[model samples]
Target chain A: GDSVTQTEGLVTLTKGLPVMLNCTYQTTYSPFLFWYVQHLNEAPKLLLKSSTDNKRTEHQGFYATLHKSSSSFHLQKSSVQLSDSALYFCALSELGSFNKLTFGAGTRLAVCP
Target chain B: GGIITQTPKFLIGQEGQKLTLKCQQNFNHDTMYWYRQDSGKGLRLIYYSITENDLQKGDLSEGYDASREKKSSFSLTVTSAQKNEMAVFLCASSISQFSNERLFFGHGTKLSVL
Candidate 1:
């Protein structure tokens, strides 16, 4: 079985501050890690994803590197903005089971002025 | 460039009642999925269809039934609603069942059982 863990349930940051959302995973095989973002009343959308270990993937000012040894794919941004407030989910899928995804209890990020 | 559409943005049901949620995807994807999202619990798979006429149970399929009548549509039914059950149901689609494909999700259906 595969599972994802998001350590922080809520993260509040001032505008222009850096933020990191912790994500760790457990899987039996090589895993595909992903970050999805959801704004109020909107569907979740893919923010970034990576399967290559140690390779950093960036999108929309967010970046994550898959660290197989550490079993982590933490999402980070250098500076937070007011519009960056949203729910962030970390998910994982085994190498062969692409249709199934295990998501972490999302982190609610609030960026304040 | 395609979208997944879920019918009835909000649903209110009585305890023990049967409720159905519908999903349609214009992505022409080969796989469709139903996931339940509870507060602080994230998304859990309810059911998935690899192709038309196919149905596979997921982690939380105990109280639900699913049907994939065509490639573009998939439906889930709550056999017997439970009192105090409230969650959002999300419908998603992927181009294939490959581990590398990205999933596209629709605006979820919020269900409340009274």
Candidate 2:
């Protein structure tokens, strides 16, 4: 019973534009993917993590790719700033259930300059 | 390289009041967490502790109440408090409970129920 699907609640962009923040997940085992970033009030960090399926993990400049046959991990950015706005979460880590996390339903990245 | 202290950044309760939220960590972590941030319903896990005293009941533990005795503290209690409720209470730490290990947050505690 692990689930995470972010369909973007809001994502207004401008400033350089090239952004994608859609993530999907649902696990029974062996799946660890994360991307958390919450600014404005601050407290959610760690903006990139993967389990190495398609391999493409990055940080700061943002990037993600853990396609495990389409379970998806999507979170990309080629250019977009204005602090990149914030509030983007997509998490799921339930293999042995220790680092317990399963979140999604957050995608408010408004970066309009 | 360590910090996670959440203590009353802002809180004001009234409806049946019984609120408490405190957490501290110096990174000597084993495990400690209490998350509940709503506004799109992103993070939700109400309790966790894996070392000194150990207690776990995440998935938004019902009315909520937790304590960890030692291991750098971890407390959360809100027995009753609901009426115009607002939420934001996060405190985390990890160096165990491994699945990849990466959680170190604490910059929240904005609860208001009046």
Candidate 3:
């Protein structure tokens, strides 16, 4: 079984401030980590994903490195924007367990201008 | 790019009533899934299908039934709706059940139980 944890249920940051959304996962098998973002009234879309250990994968100004040793893939952005206000989800999928995907309780990020 | 379509953006049902949610995908994916999203509860898997006519129960499958009527369509049924089950139901599809493919979700169907 695989599970993901997102420490914060909500994160409020001022525009232009750097932000980090914590994410950690648990799995006995090799895992794939992903970050999905959902804007208000929209479907959730993939933001970033990686299975390579210790390597950072980035998209849309956000980046996260997969740290297998710590089982974490924290999402970070050097500068936040008002448009960045949305719900972020961390997910996990085991290598061979193809169809099994687990998502964490989302963190709602509010970027204030 | 293919799109996942979920019918009836909003669903309202009386307690104990049976409600069905429909999903269709043009991605020609080999697997489809249904997940329930609640405030602070994340996405809870309800059911999944690896191929046409196949169905697999997920962590939160109780009181639910699923049908993979065709490769492009997957439907979920709430055996008996409850107020506690009022939430959004998301339909997703992946390339195949054998690949570590990412899921593409549809605009979820928000459900309400009266």
Candidate 4:
């Protein structure tokens, strides 16, 4: 079985501030970690993903590194904007379990002016 | 690019009623999945199909049944609705057999049972 944990339930930040959303996972097999973002009134979309440990993956000004030893993949961004307000979900798919993703309770990011 | 379509963006049902949700994908993907998202909660796996006629129960499958009648379609049925139960059901598809394959999701069907 696989499970993911997102520590924050909600985060509020001023525009241009740095952002970080914590994510951690547990699995019996190898891990494939991912970040999914949902804009207001829209379906969740993939933001970034990686299975390679210790390697940072970035997209759309956000980045995350898969740390196998710590079982963490924390999402971060250097500067936040109003457009970055959304719900973020951290997920993991076990190596042998094809197409099954275990997701964390999402974190709601509110970027304020 | 492929599309995953989920019918009836919103669903309302009475308690104990049976409800069905449909999903179709044009990706010709080998795997399709159904996940439930409660308000402010994590997405929970309810069912999945590896290919045509193949069904698998996920962690939250107790009250649900699923079918893959064809390669492009997968459907989920709620055996009996619960009052005050409301959630969003999402349909996703991926091209590969590996679980790590990036999944494409539909807009999701919001369900409310009274």
DockQ of each two-chain model: 0.84, 0.31, 0.73, 0.81
Best by lDDT: 1
Local accuracy of candidate 2 as per-residue lDDT tens digits, A1-113: 88898987999989898999999998879998889898888889888888889989888888999988889999999998999798989888965568898889789999998
lDDT (tens digit, per residue) of candidate 4 on B1-114:
889999889999999999999999999998899999997678998998888999989899999999999999999999999999999999998887687788899999999998
Best candidate according to TM-score: 1
Q: What lDDT would each prediction earn against the true structure?
A: 0.95, 0.90, 0.92, 0.92
What fraction of the true interface does each of the listed models get right, in terms of native contacts kept? 0.84, 0.77, 0.68, 0.89
**Chain A TM-score of model 2 versus the true structure?**
0.34
Deviation in Å, model 1, residue A101 alpha carbon: 0.5
Error of 3 at B90 (Å): 0.1
Over 4 Å off, model 4? none
What are the C-alpha RMSDs, in order, of all predicted structures? 0.7, 13.9, 1.1, 1.1
- Show pairs that collide, candidate 2: none
What is residue B111's positional error in candidate 2, in angstroms?
Answer: 1.8
**Candidate 1 CAPRI assessment class:** high
